[model samples]
Target: MTTETEAISDDALADVAYLSRSRNRITILEALRSGPHPSGRLEERTQASRSTLERILTELEERGWAERSPDGYVTTPVGERVIGEFRPVVTAMGSIRTLGEAVAWLPDEELSIGLHHFDDATVRRTTPNSPMAEATYLLELMREASVFRTLTYIAPPLSLLQSMRDSVVEGRMTATNVLTDDLVGYLRERPEQTPYWREYVEAGARIYCYRGHIPCNVFVVDETVLIANNDPDSGHPCEFIETTDETVRSWGRELIETYRRNSERLTPETFTEESRMSAEHTS
Candidate 1:
């Protein structure tokens, strides 16, 4: 007695087994991503010999995925659907091995739930010697955004901090910055730069200090683009994932809001007092 749900599960398992059985078939399917191709062309692209290609093609046609067309062999609508369903799985398998310790910076629950939203995102990586590369890219994105929000686990590069201040000063962008307490302590140590941060406050950039730890860094620009960054302390190369996918954007926005809700607003007067007391303690 196979229920409808059980039938669907069986079909799905069969499809998975079929796809996993042959690397040659996978190559042919991926080659078809650009569009239809003649058997000869597919042979060249997939690097499968004629006999092997013909067998794969026959199997694909029987599966309702490949069809003979006036132009050549094209993937059918069913094939396209199958490819779409497998896209995130393919992307995850490709990227997961490279992510290293950076993967730990994201909440396990969030990653488990929404990691696929990152399938189409662009990743930027930086070497230890090039620590500021991703930050520079982020600044470029910020310059093009009218409104931006950031949830940061680490202090931003000084150059980027200055650029945000300049953008606020010039009335080019509005920003909301959420910071960990550790970053606030660092700012306190550099009292000389406190006035610039005050200017940032006056220029309409709001700051919030989260009472506890935030695992990753998120920047949402114009509510359209989201950038997720790993902690530099992770010992792996720093990396950032940028995406315009609306689902990913929403996820980033929600992460930012979570931090904001747990944070206390930081005003210039309060910040100055905090910095002064810290300076006194250190002196």
Candidate 2:
């Protein structure tokens, strides 16, 4: 059996030292995340006793996680990088574990950058008895927002459409939506729903259809999104995340904008032609 000392390389061991799992040490490092701070301030911020603070600070300085300058103690570049990478994982993992396989709805790259946003967000799990819970919660989120944006794999149901129409008519909200190419085609084929979408267009909601890229089911209400997996045939419980984290919301908006920029405007005249063009290109 490899001893702990023999198993870890010198460089790896050094990193471990910097990120020592000691609660007090970790607290001190987190307290310095805002900027440099004097010893007194660090003690107060971390709520670590003077002796504990002193030891951790000394260790941090030795490990290059901190530096004592004329003004105060500051986190070093290496320390910043470690914290930046580490904290997000720890924070996001809480949500990811709850989300399970449903977390794959967001692109891997976007998820990495925005995971921290959902650190304090809530997750709602849906069962067969409450199949419409996700949509209901999404509508409530929309109702709470002054401005909303969304990327959807499925078309809005009549109930959601009516609610959105009421919100728009009352001047309560404005929205932009991006739908997958296939959904747009599906809507075009369904005559009953055509008027609903047309009414949305008349209410001043902007709509676009993305041809490529994987479909995402996300609803962004101001700084939060109702996010869930794109599974339509799964019998397992569906997981949804509702978050107001600025980073995640910003990324969600940017994601929609990227599709919007590359997508076709969903006007009645362009619907058929654009759908055909998208199908040909995708094929």
Candidate 3:
């Protein structure tokens, strides 16, 4: 890739710009990738006027992107490679658009978002009637999984925690949480959750407290990964992007465990001391 990047010539940029100026030209070139097609077939596919089609084909042949074969117009090796690489950029645009505001909160510096990983993902957002839509969807995934882990800077929905606890109590699931110092403080202040936390621990759930690097909330349930963000206005779980893509899931697991390995394991008995250390670290 380094060699290829260095080898890219000024003429290649000009070729790209030239093809980009006319959508019809790109359409015709992409169509020829499969096999040879007559000029009339290209016209029907591109829906361009005869004059426009003829001019575009002439330009393509001149630029070495397409050629007139005995069968018809066919894509050359140069055209094939150009479109093969260019197609991903086009796909990335659609993925970016589909992600919408979720893109803003993603930890892009650490997690390189790639094409196709989230293309077929299930994206959930807080709706007017269901503001906890994102969190609820996570609970749904938890209900079906045998193991789940999370790395978060803020507390998860209490209901989701309760569901995790109950499932773990039945000896049907394993749960682990890698929390930031901020979240430890969040939980420390929630007195109502103290006893529940103890019960959650007794039920075989694991908790570890780490200081930082938890930019966005991550939930990995069995083979699925959910990346979530809060609604800026409501401060509630807003968007949840979930996928079972192996690359993303592998990355997610690595991220969670990497934090956990660096964290201090917490038990019910040590919660207060952990909170105190977290407070001092923050102060």
Backbone N/Cα/C clashes per model = 0, 0, 0
Give Cα-based local distance difference scores for all models: 0.74, 0.73, 0.79
Clashing pairs in 2: none
Which structure is stronger by TM-score: 1 or 2?
2
RMSD of 1: 6.5
1-283: candidate 1 lDDT, tens digit per residue: 9888766776888898898788888778766655888899988887889999999989999999878888788788888777767766766665554444435545675543445665556667777698777767777876777888888766655666777888899999998989887877777667666777888888889999987877767778885554455656554323666677787677777778877888998887645856669656876
lDDT of 2 by residue, 57-128 (tens): 888888788898787888998877777776766667776776566566666655546555566677777777
Give the number of the best model, judged by TM-score: 2
Q: What is the C-alpha lDDT profile of model 3 across 168-205, one tens digit per residue?
A: 88888998999887777678767666556667788888
Q: Please state every model's RMSD to the true fold in angstroms.
A: 6.5, 5.0, 5.7
TM-score of 2: 0.78
